[model samples]
Target: MSKIKQFFVRNKKKILIGLGVFLGLLLVAFAIFFLNRERLLQYAVKKVVQKVENRYPADLQIGKAQFKGLATVLVTDISFVPENQPKLLQIDTVEATVSVRSLFLGRLVFKQFDVANGDVTAFKQDSVDNFSFLYKKKATGEEEKTKDAKEKSNYGTILNRLIETAFENVPDGVNFRNLGVIFQNNGRTISMRLPTLTVEDGQIQGRMAITTDSITNTMYVNGVIDPDEYLLAAKMYAEKAGGIQVPYIQQKFGATMRFDTLSLSITDKVFKNDQLTITGESSAHGLVLNHPKIADEDVFVKNGALKYVITLGNHYYSLDTLSEVRVNKAVFYPQLTYETRPNRKIGVKIDSPNIPANDLFESMPPGLFDTFQGMRANGSFKYHMDFYVDMAKVDSLTFNSDLDGQNLEITQFGEQDLRKINREFEHTVYENGKPTRTFLVGPSNPNFTPYNQISNYLKNAILTAEDPRFFTHKGFHEGAFRHSLITNIKEGSFVRGGSTVAMQLVKNVYLTRKKTITRKVEEALIVWLIENLNLSTKQRMYEVYLNIIEWGPNIYGVKEGAQFYFSKRPSELTLEESMFMASIVPKPKQYRTYFNQYGELRAYPRYFFNLISGNMLKRGLISPSEHASVSSYVNLNGRAGNFIMAKPDTTQIMDTLQLAPIDLLDF
Candidate 1:
């Protein structure tokens, strides 16, 4: 103790000097912080906002920045532009509290961020929409460019691609208060009532009510993102607010669909252009969807429970084939696929467990099969549909199916049945799927003919030309479906029907002619119903189809077609005439122009007729005698039909001169 006292007495002045030096350094630090505080706050906030606003094509700014508490900053006059929008969004003020210790290390570590009272207006123009751009970049171009390059080299699973889009630089927490969003597009506006939206950790949850087109619904959604952190903050909010109250809205298929309750489990890398798998359950109630091209009597899902897993790929931007889906209590697997170059295939497969016929019917919107729903149905059935495509050529578009059970029942009729077959089914205004038109082809036209009255040659020719596998297939064929699928994908349009007799019958009888998705879906449903219900015998269905199908200008039935073209009864038509019938079936009106100035059929018609004859013979559809009789000459002036004579052997005949048949499956 004595030695310590002596040392202290000797160094009192030196100790005082050291203390003054330390105080001077502290004062300088305080002075620098006070002088540059605004600049630091602005730098930190602007950096973060810019990162968050990268997806928005607008300007964002803050004004009147000032210090609040020791580590809190208050920024006023926050605005996001362009300012001329009818629903401009203006945030009156924002407060950010950061970690003071982090500031000392030159890092901006946010503790809490809050945005209060934001008012936003959104509207659409005739040619453009304000929110349209929001999703325009849904696929990030830069990220995509890099990803494409990587795909070329790696071309792995979609999950690999998803990994390329990594999510980083996420915020600790963000809060919004009194936010309002109104959207107007195409003279229709939807308003969203979202009192608050908060994003923290790895979850994006909200509850909101949205109204548009005089319909409203409340949506509640809770989703887990970035499963890697699912455990960290899983219970963080339990101690504070049990749950957040959020309001939001979603637009799908150009329509507003409501979700009463939605629980989602999705990976966090979605925004990063990486692989995304979303598993969710939804409860929907009485929601009538609206689309610009949708019918006024738009279909609605009243109430239902659904659970689904959706997966997306990076290269083809297509859905994966392995996914589970449930509606009500029924379970099904739906797969949509897009392949790369050389293969270039697009396909869809729906596999469902056997289900009750009425239950299945009731689950789907009745209007989808308004005409077919009247058919009596009983029993349970399961089916698999394979829409095969080869996007390399124009010929291979096939929609094939296999039905496991016969659960439908149909009533029979006499010749009067032919009259009922003539009813005009719903038809499309065009192939665009908007605005439907009723094609009145029947209600029992006088030209209708019974199955027995129709010529067997015409039947064989139509079967061989349209669908050789029609009798064996339920709705579509296997080889043809695969081939046709490819062709459709290549053309990027439904130019080719790639349909079987059953599908064609449903289309001509119960749906519009438009090539839109709606028509196709309706056509599929009706075909399924008819086939499963056995609404009519195949023979009767064919009779009805021939009677209702469009033949030419003002010509609706085969009877009218037979009298108009050959001036004879269907039964009296010869084999050559039958081939002509089949050839012109696709373009009956165009066939009328094939006659020369002399008023006789042209060489082009004879050529196609002969081609189909050879095809029929090769397929063993026609006997040798029938082939000979039909191939005798052309009908230009009572000549038989056209043929390329050579060795009689089937194999030898095909080896010479590439006869190149008319290709009925050709567009």
Candidate 2:
């Protein structure tokens, strides 16, 4: 061996001892770091909360943390304060048992989360509230910028990933005790006492009790929920509580309604990326209602209970369509479905037998049922409403009703009273209540003309178009009323009045123009009075009706209608011109749109002209021979036979240059 090699071999043991000391010092440093990990975590969590406060609508305060070992931690005094609210949530302490294996694997996993003594408050003051944080719409450009920042931010991603993994991995226990919630809305306060809440494995269980105005109830929610949703799964059970009274709905109609029971159960689970696929069954009972104003009206729903299932996916929820709601012996089913994808479709259906009209009408405003107050509505009815859309394009909508009120009798206003109101015509008239806006309607007015002064063809057309049974019936025409109601219900809007001449006269002369329940009721009562009390002669009523009716914009009465559409005497209007005039009476203002720039009738007006003409022929208002002549030459002649006039609609000829005289029948 060389001398250099021999000298190094002797000192090798000393060099090894120096390296061992260095490694031991490094181990001691590591032990110190492990022991103080909880403090470091606490600082980190506080800093993160401060950073999040800038983006979140609420404020968060983290508490001091202490570690039992490397994995177990106890945090004290945590709180959340919403914007404009101080301390919306307060937590006294939280002890968390964690997974050591997950820590070694660089994953945060909670074995258990035990929360003790916490209070949460939710208040909605107008549009601002404690829970509003969930609904806060981020300012423009903020969300996009945040997403971009998150993608590039490493520290933020690490912190969030760790926190999310702690809950997402299905914590062994999610339990709470003495957690309370206080809610206030619209000048009313509601308190809910949550006694015990527990979630273990896949089971969710909770119990709560509440007491409020007109309601005192205890609710229990027990179900199995998705385990991965450790944070939100517990709250699903809270949704079952019901039987709360709404002051607005009650006061608006002067009625009190009880919900009985409404318990929402969420079942099924889709934990992928925290998506929820909730479906469950629930039961409801009671639902009694009463109105103080309506005489002896009470909806005593005896053991009225209902059971239904609900499902939620995407962003919307729907109740089972086949579920039946029972009230006493009557069984009624209500169905509602809403979905949005490439399109939106909503469907609603309700059907029942012998649903007392009074039971429904009592809790509702009197205006909607004023006309039927004295009549008994018997039989069955079905209501259907639906709207559809596809590929972001609108589709045809359908809303229809089938009301069968069999054997209805309005004994109060019978034919006896009807014959009496058909007698007074020599003077002015006004609606009984609305004395303001006095409509001076007398023959002395240029547009005022008696039935005798009107053209025979016009009279025939009026009777045929408005009421075929006008001469025979009293004030009510059930067939017309039924058809009008069906049409209005189906369209989901009011387009025509199922009113008789007497009803129309009463509405125009006596009631306010505003459409309301009160006005409608008044109109019904007055129409009954006009017909039953012999308020006016039928001929006189028809004459006054022609004088006061709105024919077009700024055009009132058939006299103005005559001169406005055809600058000629009302007696000189030909069959074609009169039919044209009648076609526009229902929607005169909109009918004006029918006249294009060329002073020619539009398609709808032209169609109505032909249809009414055909109807007039069918009714024998004009002889078949006369109808042929009227139909041949009159393609809606604009004003003059020559189609002549210097300016647009300066003057109009009656389209009656050479008309064959028809057989005139006197009333």
Candidate 3:
């Protein structure tokens, strides 16, 4: 033991001396680095400028760059200009403080940042733009190799990294003065001027003046942002009393949106177990929206809020079922997921359990349910829906929806009486939003045919071609809706609508011809009330539908349609004629396209005849012999024959069978 101790004591001095020498060298190196730090920074900046200029068609310049303190940098006269384009960016002065500790850890973390007198402009003329280069990636001939790599990419990791980087770069304090962002495309220009914007002690305040074309608006924003905690809250409101109007949308996208106040907050963001979860809330008061495709009039929502929990995984993103949406007084929980691995799939689920009937009714946005105004109802209803679709097997999609009302009753009718269809009522036929004609839907009008006056063949054909389960179902056909959803998604457009006869009847009798989401929702609600409440008998509703539906140009009821095409009364129509009439119900304005120039039926209508006849035969609505006897040939003996072409043109034949033939089938 004594020998070992003596050996250790002899070697300890040399070991200590070597450690001291190494420490001294490290200190000397750090001292040299600090002494030439300014030069190193300048070199780095020069290299960055050179790299950027070489990579993009842009030029970057800096008049001066120097360090104010150990961790503070000040730069002057910074500008970026693209080739053959206007000045893209300009800055008079910029100052920022970095965290020395973070720098040692190889991270650039900001403490304080300030910018003065800067302008960022994006201009586009014809097909050229000034700012697109920022997002353009140079082709490396490896994109094809990486095309299938997206399925294996970890979304949660990427998103977490982005969030961390963004938060790290957000300074604890910021001051921006006289900053302007301008956008110009062709002849249109939009400018936003921020005279003063500041963030101090996690609180933010900003005032912006926006100008689009000749209109100017002022908006105020106040928020709290905690970068360290990944929390942010903001409120945006207009300077004036009314809602704030967003610029560029109305002119560029033909849509207008206004909101009285918009509030947004991110409560938390966390990454764990290869999954990222983010929670946030957004609310809007007095929101108004208008688009020709959405509605004719502006749709108004008094109050709406959404509390969302979003999740991201390796190959999927989801809105968790914990997310809740509040519209006026009603609340609903919604869940949605989109996956890309194995096969692309989408799943959506919504649940609103046992909500008050009045709350639901009152929650309907204004201008969407104008007829439902002043309506009072009793009892509550629960709505649930689950939909799943795998892109590889869309035909095997799963969809189920239910809106069950418990002892529901409408005690008071709204603007329109629910039971009016059972009696004589004035029904107006509109063409292009203008009232073309008005007629009585009951016994008072000479052309009005009762249920019995219409031939059973015509009724059966219309039912088979329009809504096969119209009599059995309450108001909606889930299978048809599922099919419609699938078809629309496949086509990437609204090529088919799964409207039942009841919906069509409501639309024609009480609603205008304008096609809009609002109209459709209102139509569905009305159909539900009429059918579920027994306000109108099935026979009466069918009669009304037959009396008011448009069959051809300027042709309004079954009587006019039968006479216009066949010069026969509704009760005198044959099975073949009824099928022809049913075929034209979808595109009445294009009925002439169904015939060749010789006024004979084209080949497309034959598919409809066979489909409808086959369905009828399968349902025993028609005998096998009767179905075999049915023919696709039809003769236009009425005024419709005058519109036929003088020569045969196969190209003019309308592909009506392509327009949802499965929907037309009774099955």
Candidate 4:
């Protein structure tokens, strides 16, 4: 012990000197770090801000940064709030943490992160406006309060801030923990309520998440949210206006609408239910308040009130309201069932009987329904729908509803907020008048009209012109097809089509109308399947045919042709108007010149129309006296002025079985 002590005493001076040097080096390093800390953090934050600006091009600023270790960096209060900006939005707070491992490497490696609290406020002046996060720079002398007030009140500012924090270019190969969001806008609020949020690359996952109730002030979504899986659900709603309704019917249906472009996707997990059920409804305003069957009854109300109650066996729930109706506040009750691998059955139900119909209608935004004429109706109805799902997709959905069928008094939800309504109406009018109208018509028409009326006209006209043997055949009319096929083979160039109406429907719906044997086989197979299933009749075949048939440049359907050629309704066509419309059935443009100059074609197709009508008369398709009168009235170039008709063709005529496509195209 004495010898060791003597050795230690001898080396004490050397050890002291070494220790002193080490302490000096440590002090120097810390001093250098502290002094340059501002610049270092400035460079980093500036670079990040610049990147975000380049992408989003917005007003962005990062709070002063603090570092604890060589690796741990914290940005305390970052914001992307804009001032004097019309387009850009703002956010409240954004916090970021750098991973400890990649400190000196000059690359972002985020292993753990905490985004404690944030708020987003978004706004747009109108539905037609595109949401922009960048604001225009304005004069500096602008009123400070006005500028600040605009920024503060602007919800877009909050949106921008939240986007930067949540979606900034995070480093690869890093883990995340506990990310959350809480936002509110009047009647609605969203709490991302993620107890744990993990993210790596493009993959994101969350646990114990909840989406609060939008209408009845309840939480609609509560469970683990896998961005990848829940994304699909989000996508379904994103594309469609009304996402999904749980309860079949209530006082009013609740739904969300998208008037602008937005995209969302699932990240990692899927939507599931320990016990699951879904209900949905789609009703137009006319169906709700103006159907002829219920039009005359008490519809408009000075005092609008609605109420509903449901009793599922023993459980019961009730809803009440006293005003206009919004289309989404219905409740959904799920009956959940389970099954084992081989063959087992288990059933479960989630039920809600109390749905407030009046409350739903009253919750509608001002001016949703601006005005009404003698409309009065207020009552509550209840409906139930159950879904049977095996694994994922629905197996069956059974819907049942009891419409209270009460005398309802209807009135505008909002007093004549005419300014908004007029603006919308004017925009729609301008859009319809634009050259874009041609785009709407397209090569095939999407004309909105009853399917039955158009079908009857096209069928009779086709049979009057083409083949009379359309209905008796399977996919092909054996006698007519054989005869036409022989003639086409002899001619070397195709002059006629033996295609039946069924074949035409098949070709139009399932396959392209290519004049080739391969396409023909496909068309035939589709036709065979449609016929074999016995799903459609000859009249239905014609309806489908006219819907997809090309009538002219950017025109389709018999109704469209009737309007385009005659400027009249299909039912209002006179005998000559009918014949003139039918004359072009073979080739719409081939005979368009006949009517382009007010029915001026004094030549070929008209002569054929008369011949075909004459043959039909001989075949008892039309009365002789009627045929004689129609023939006498024919002025191939005749104007159908003041030609009011008695009745449109009916289904009985469609079922006559003699009219065929061959007869229509033959002439």
Candidate 5:
């Protein structure tokens, strides 16, 4: 040990000198790197431009790029132009400071970013667009073959990564001046200009001016963000006194939406146990919406808010039951889940627990519930709904909904009185938003038929064809509604409506014929009021329904319809004649389609007759003898027969009728 120490001491000087030389060389190399940092940055920029140009159908150019400070980069005259297309992106100058530690880890984390002047414009003419290439994928043959074999996506992981990446890209400080984004398609253009936008110390302030064709609007935005905690709160409002009008929707979709103050916030985002949960809140005040299909006038809401908790798992996404939705003073809880594995399924549940009747009435949107505007009510109502559907087994779908009122009563009426149907009143028929005819719906009218005067066969047939359980149920037939929902889902379109006799009666008596959600909802409210309050007896309501519903073109009520088709009074109509009248209720204007040029019933109508007759027989509404007495053909001897006879005989009668078996539950 002593000899080794002596030898080490003798070489210590030489070792120290060698170590100093190595350190000096390392310092010299770092100095050289620092000196050529600008060149290195430019080369890196060139490489990135080459890569982008090679991968996309675009050319990226940067006139100059250099290092301004230790971790700051300055770029000027950057442009990205697609081949044979307009320039997609252009920037006059940009300066960004990146995290030096992140740079060593091969990641560019911006600490501060500034843009002096820039513009991004997407243009489309015919079938080509300049910006679509950003989302276009250049998949190889191998990738295409392996795509189906790829493992199922982990929604939790994906969402977590998305949130992380988004927050990572948010710089601590940002300053943008004179930035514009424009989108032009065909002849329409939508442009937004940001004169100035700044974010400092987690606070954001910005001003945006939007132009759609000839209309322009300005908005002010203010927000606060916490990057490390994934928290954000933002609000947007108009520069003027009213709400901010959303641009382009009115021109493109024929819809208008405006909001006085829109606020959004993300309170928390947590990832644990292979799941991601996010909580947020959104609120709007003085919201206005308008569309031809939604309503004739603008729908206005005073205040609305939603507090939501969303969760993402491996094969499912869910909105937790903790979510609460509030409109004015009314509040409800909603839960929704969608699964992608083990047979795709969707489930939804909503619960509103006994809110005040007055609050509920006041919560209704203005234009939508005009009939309930000034309505005063007492007591409270609770609602619950649970719906689930498996795409693979839609036939086994489950749907249940209930609205229970606790001694609910109306003290005052709105624009339209609810109790008018109890007495004789003038009923008007509207076609295409115009009143075509008006008639008295009582014994005073010559053609008006009393409930008892109408043949039982006619009433039974109409009930069977329209709503089999109308007399037994309050206002809604759950089975028929379920059938309608199933059919609509299978068809992927709205081809059926589950309207009961009472609903139809309410619609005919108190609502317009125009098909709108507002009108349908109003019809439902009226039906509920009438049924629950016993304002009109079941027989009286059915009587009014038969007296007001259209059965054929220019034909109204059972008396007119029976005479128009069979030249007989309602009480004198035969079973076959009643079935014929029932069949034409859905499409009164196209009744001729059910008959041939010879005025004989078509094969489908014959099957419909048998179906209705069979249902009536099962319900004991008609005896076996009466069911067997139904004729296989309909004889139209009134004005309708003349129209059918005028058509040329081009349809060939089928020898063997083949139709899908109708669901017994549908009736």
Candidate 6:
């Protein structure tokens, strides 16, 4: 015990020195951290920017930035320049205050954001280059929300957020204090003010107080709208224009409508008098109407004359007339029409006993078609003042004249003919070398289809072509791989592949269409991963495949392909047609050159159809009767000159088919 105490005393000096050195090092570390705080923050910001750019790409550029440790807020000045546009759409120069408390919560608790005092400038371009700041994409569940810096867009994702945010409830759950909007066009400007508004799920609910008076027209608007329904209604509103020839009216109109402070309520109202109690909104930029549920029968049909009120700017226009009114009510009565003469002239006539001819003509303003400037209107009335339209102003005249009541009874006037005006149809071919002109359907095609059918067809096709035993085999096709390598070596070039359908689906959906073995190999791996993923739905897979598949030369989708070749819907394809379609699954363009004068299919490419169908039958994929039907119909020809543009009943035909699966090894 005495020796131990003596040793401790001797080492006391050394122990004190060691403690002093440790304290000195700790102080030095603190000094460094405090001195380089700004540089550290700058570095952090740069790293954040890099990460954001990697995740969410956009044409984003940041200028000056300021961070206050005390307030825990970051102020950044930003400029947004959309891709392909040299002009800047927005510039925020003021302080963008963010809550430090929210940041801490975002880091460890919940994700919430607040923006204060962000000075921004928004630009509206010509018809070709308008700026849109909304993100209208489907939200997936796997998104990460805890990142310090997230990628964003000014026109795309940002706009989408703003739209979604507009419907987001106020944090404190308070009704809006004010909502105001000013719409400007040419020399005319209209303003709408709503002091009180409430935001809820996809709806802005408030009374809009409006007042407007022009030289020739005046309107007052006092109504409530449900913004979500209004959005749907706006889409339907433009569609209601049906055959009207207007230049991007749907896109241009929404920019003028501002609903941040106003709540829109959409409702369906039964009729009372000549008014409709419409509750829903049309779309972003559209006129407000009463809820449909409260629609008045009298407004639709009243003593042979339609009477209704329209709110524009701030005043309401009470209109009662029998003809020549551009409003939709005038056309809903069914037989009403405005015909433009062929001589670049204008005239008005009505065929209603209750509606006096003088009142009808007087109700319509002269040179109404003049607003459509470049388009000219010419022609004289027929025996009963029924005018013949000149080609120049035909589109404008159609717009000003509602198609609802007027059928515009020009016998043999097919609605499909209008597709030619915009070159909506393209020349293409189907199996059996049949040539045809097909319509280009946008996302709004009328075909009713579930997503699965298209996905399965694509999956099966790829599997059959690449690896027949995809379902039963593991990720790799060993036999197919060896065969492919040997065959390539023997041929002295890449001649075949052994990728499965799952792989092809992955390639088509996510990767580029490069014809290389490297890409194919990567695609195969991706396919295995995707198939194993629980996210892939049968319908979703088929829908994507159906859209991406090349059904013919410049033709895509079963809907368009079926319609193009046979002038029939997808459901109407016969057994022979199905076999023909399946036969051409390997190559689309090889048999796309056999069409009649009217762009109708005149023959089928028999070689591929016969070869594939025969093989499928021999492998027991199809029964004897199914094989017989397909063989008999493969090369049959229709009567010459009997082809016409007509819709055929599809339901009965698709139901009549008794198809069989092809053997896996036949291909």
Off by over 4 Å in 2: 1-57, 67-72, 83-85, 101-109, 135-171, 211-216, 228-261, 268-280, 289-617, 620-667
Candidate 6 backbone clash number = 73
Residue lDDT tens for model 1, 122-197 = 7787966554343233346888877555544333343433343333334566677766778777777788776666
lDDT per model, in order? 0.58, 0.56, 0.83, 0.43, 0.82, 0.37
Where does candidate 1 have its weakest 10-residue lDDT segment?
A: 233-242
Best by lDDT: 3
TM-score of model 2 relative to the true fold?
0.43
lDDT computed for candidate 1: 0.58
The residue-by-residue lDDT of candidate 3 on 1-667, one tens digit each, is: 6998888798999889999999999999779868877766676667768877988788999989788887788889999999888889999998988655544443445678899999999999997889866534444567844632442377676667677866766777999999999999897888999998899889999988889867777878899998888998999888655548865678878998888888999889999987899999999988998988788898899999999999998788999989999999989999999998888999999999798889888998877788888888999878898999999998788898887888999998878888898889998888789998888887888988888888888999988888888788998888888888877777778888888888888888788779887888788878877888788888788888999888888888899999999999999999999998988888887777777665666766777788788888887888989898997678888999888654464554333324542375434
Per-residue alpha-carbon lDDT of model 4 for 1-667, expressed as tens digits? 6998998899999989999999999899777866775566666566767766766635676655667566466666556644453333332333345653233333344554555444344444443222343332233565865664555433334333433344444443233233445444343454554444445444445443435554221112211223222222111111233323222122223322221111233232211221111111222221122212222222222221222221111111112121122334444444444454333333333344544435434433222221221222255434343323233222222222222222333333333221221111111111222332221212233463444455343455565565466666555565455445344444555666667766765544443333444356445544543454344566556544555455555566666667765676666666666666665665665543443234333445446557666766666666777677764233422223233222322213221112233533332
**Which portions of model 4 show Cα errors greater than 4 Å?**
1-39, 50-57, 68-70, 86-95, 99-111, 122-168, 172-196, 200-203, 207-467, 471-611, 614-663
Q: By descending lDDT, how would the candidates be arranged?
A: 3, 5, 1, 2, 4, 6
Which is better, 3 or 4, measured by lDDT?
3
Mark the regions of model 3 whose C-alpha exceeds 4 Å error after superposition.
1-115, 120-162, 181-191, 211-215, 272-276, 311-317, 339-344, 490-492, 589-600, 631-666
Question: So what's the TM-score on candidate 6?
Answer: 0.27
Candidate 6 on 108-218: residue-level lDDT in tens?
A: 111222332232223343433323423333233436332111322112233234434553423322243344444443433455555555433333344444433331111
Tell me the deviation in Å of residue 293 in model 6: 63
Instruction: Name the lDDT of candidate 4.
Output: 0.43
Cα error, candidate 5, residue 288 (Å): 1.7
Instruction: Report the C-alpha displacement of residue 185, candidate 5, in angstroms.
Output: 7.9
Residue 595's lDDT in candidate 3: 72
Per-residue lDDT tens digits for candidate 2, residues 10-60, read: 988987898999999988966876875655566556665766587677888
Each prediction's TM-score versus the true structure = 0.61, 0.43, 0.78, 0.32, 0.79, 0.27
> Against the true structure, what is every candidate's RMSD?
11.1, 16.2, 7.6, 22.3, 7.3, 29.0
lDDT over C-alpha atoms for residue 560 of model 2: 71
Worst 10 residues of 3 by lDDT: 653-662
Query: Model 5, 482-561: lDDT tens per residue?
Result: 77778778878777787878888877777777788788878877888889888878988888889898887778998998
